[model samples]
Target: MLDASGYTVISGPVGSYLAERLAAAIASRNRWNGCVWLRRPQRNLRSLDAALAEACAKRWRADTHPTDDPRRRLERALLGSPEGAVVVVEVTDLTTAIGRLMTGLRPLASDRGVRLVVVAEGLRLPVVRFAPDALVAPAALGGVDGLAARVGLLASAPVAARRLTRLAERRPAVATDLLDAAAVWPHDVLLGALAGRTRTLERVTAALLDLCTPAQRSALETCATTGYWHPQLDTGVVRAADLRPWLVPLEESWSWVRPIWLAPLRRALARRGPSPVVARPAAAGPGSPDDRRLRPPDDRRSRSTGDQGSRSSEDQGSRWTGRGVVEVRLFGGFEVRVDGVVVDFPGRRGRSVLRFLLTRPDRRCPRDQLLEEFWPDVDGRAARNRLQVAVSGLRSALRSATNDHVIEYASGEYRIAPAVRVRTDVEEFEEALGAARSAGRPDVALSAYHQAIDLYRGDFAADVPYESWTLLPRESLRLRYLDALDAAGRIALRTGRIDDCVVTAHRVLEVDPCREDAHRLLMRCYARQGRPHQARRQYELCRRLLAATLSVEPAPETTALYRSIRPR
Candidate 1:
């Protein structure tokens, strides 16, 4: 038994018995309304209908709507219902149900006085746009005793009502509300708030309503809406309007056109403001090649002299020497070699720093970007100091090994010099694949691709966890490399290079067993090489792997390949 005031989500497998018990309890109370959200109505239709009927008989209005029809049902239930009505939305399949609820119910719940109960069997409450007022996992209901006791309390007097409210607030259900509010607020504010320190939709709404604005709240909202402003433009001095023109275009394009656009804007604004103009060097006559360049040479010479003296003062600053290859082997272990010698780079942090640089060699890596990628857990001065130490160690290591300073620091950025020979196995693999596409001889290209395939010992730093920066490129390169092998294998088989084709196809399968192309290539290679049994066996293995991993049968192409290889 439950009261008219509370909302619930009856989550679990359709015939898990928990749904029936929840229905019976709600029925006894005669105050709750039930709505079952299921993926496949045909499977759970009978049981759910039975539960709905039982709840309805007890004076609780009940309905069943498939997750696909959530928007219609939720709108009908919320807007159409009498005041203080309790709606229980049963989500039989968590994924489908969550998707529907997040897309539909969240906005409705936010605007109206409605509470959502997500019934997912084993899942934590589905993350919705607008947080649910309460969350009740069937397991947390703690069997029949806890469920009955809570229901009985809900049916009791006003004193019991206060206790029930307190208990429900303590439930994990409250987290749903908090997270939901957090999810929708920022975006809502960004779209809603026209002025003030509104960075996110959440902050705008919270500011409009005059809720708690934590020290970082405005800053976070600014970063979310306007992009990260340079620390030089301290929030104390700078306002949101100062950022909007550039921010609007950048936000529209979804480009990080921050600090980049900000610099020019700041200079323009400063010039327009009450800032004193500094005098420039006197111009040379018309014949002089840009007087600015001529005046700068004398100043540049003096600065160069100063830099030379400073360089002499420092101990062994000339480490990155000569135009030699910076070989980065990023399979098995993360290794960096200048030419062929394995230089000892100081600190694990420094090694990681170098690895990041080597991955995108000859490109400018900003200090902030590096800090965010590498020392994400640390913040402010600590992260900066760590980066400085790592950069110093990298410079020292390169200088000691090669006797040439190849890593150039300029304009608050670090880059591997263009002249330096940077050779990564990944890069080499890409190069070989490029050659294969253009080479006049298919066999020559196949050989080069095979060599490239051999270089990929394993997943790029397989030991490393999935990082936001590395995962995308790593997976992309890995997939591309595998595809190249598949293509090369097909070419090899077509050219009657049976042994080479079989070897390369097998290698492809080792990395990705369900690669349909690899399976087809291998089958064709085996059959052409007079190995029908092996071809059939390969098909069976692929079929099993596909079924196990993806829960789907092999495509017609795969079965066709097997049929072609069957013993006649």
Candidate 2:
């Protein structure tokens, strides 16, 4: 139900069967006043603005303001439309571009009489927080009364259909897969697959598990063994959205793994018996933590407080003794390991404290600053207590795998132990970039640049992009990465590596669609390949992105390049 805001957000997996059915229902109801459906296909490279323009073409037939952007154009068109006119937007993914677009449209849509329906995958916090009314449509695939009819099993074997539905964990996607298998195989073969007598079910289950991080898998395994998750477990590290169409929420903090997955998890656990190997962390997107052994620190100098830099007890020749460095990965995801084993923190807050301290150039931070940064919403005394608890928890977690003196407190300041050797991806990334810049030879510089680029798995601490302290640093690292890519592209172009130039240029556009220079780079690459038509298409995409999103034309340089490449 929508409140005074006239904004309704449907939360679920974007392409799921239930979400699509609900969207169709909404469109059917709003057909009287006119419903504009805006959707982008998976393979479509067109921007969201292009989708919107196409959807509202009939409504926007009348002249719009000359200076209006996509938002304003839609607003003008909506304001003049009949009452109850609704715009149903199908969001493919929640990128930065979509976030900005939604924020601007929310208020304008609220003030107007028309209703705005946003069908988005995962939970969009901004949409939920800003909207006066929001609804999360359930994704459960319960009830088997009409299930057999839908899958063509009711007349032939109703009982088997009900049993199959239950075995599929009542998940529409899983049930559909089972039905597809049934169609291809004989009854005995299908039964064998379901019973795990064949490898078919195992293969399918393994594919789904592959998407999860080590932590998520561990959590799921625990849930499979026990009925519920431990209350103190940091489930925030498990992105529910990422587990979608398979894992569903049983309650606010607990998740219900589909029945299809339960037997496989239990069997795998039984096979391992004791000391099961923890899978390394997968290379996930922002806020994703993956496990991999990090390279040791290049420098062996101890971080001592005094000018003389006396080595502390813990640092006394540990590097030579062959104890591995405490590898802290802050880029892409937040992960720490000692001797190649992943360290598990007590909670997300403890991990956050560790990340905050690592970002400090001096490796020390004032106690007051930490409390203010991490626990600002709480009262002073409570916030201070929380900070201490977080720090203590962080220290304990690290101590389990390394020296007890990994963290130290002195004179109202908290810092990493001066004696401990640490290596971080962020440092490695910067060092490689520095090496690239200082290299005298083009080949040397190009190699350094590629090394730096590879180190940047994703944005810094990408898993927690919205945190207050990470905002500036995240943007800073992203710009540096873009610059490195630009440099690499230019060098590759000069060296006659047309393919490398094209690849780097495409990577830049993926991160920031409005990167006009990257578009020009692609234009040049395509023209070099003697593909003027493709070059013109690139220019048109650039112009449309600028006009629709920024309400501006491409720069003069871009136009001139396009003119030269045009089939004149």
Best-matching candidate per lDDT: 2
Give each prediction's root-mean-square deviation over alpha carbons. Answer: 25.4, 16.9
Total backbone clashes of model 2?
6
* Model 2 lDDT-worst window of ten: 299-308
Model 2, CA-based lDDT: 0.60
lDDT of 1 by residue, 1-568 (tens): 2321234445542123344345544443233543332322222433443433343234334253445243454454455444334445444344433434443555664455444444444334434332344344422332223322433323434443343244333332322222223333343332233222322223333343333122223322324323333332222333333333233221222222233233443343333321111111222332111111111100101011111111221211222233566767675457676755667776877877676777774656888889999888997799999898888888888787687676887888878887787767677667767876787877556655644554565677664645566787778878987887777777767777676577567667767878888888878887887878767867876887799899998899989879877684
What overall lDDT, based on C-alpha atoms, would model 1 receive against the true structure?
Answer: 0.50
Badly placed stretches (over 4 Å) of model 2 are 1-321
Best candidate per TM-score, number? Answer: 2
Write down the TM-score of every candidate.
0.42, 0.50
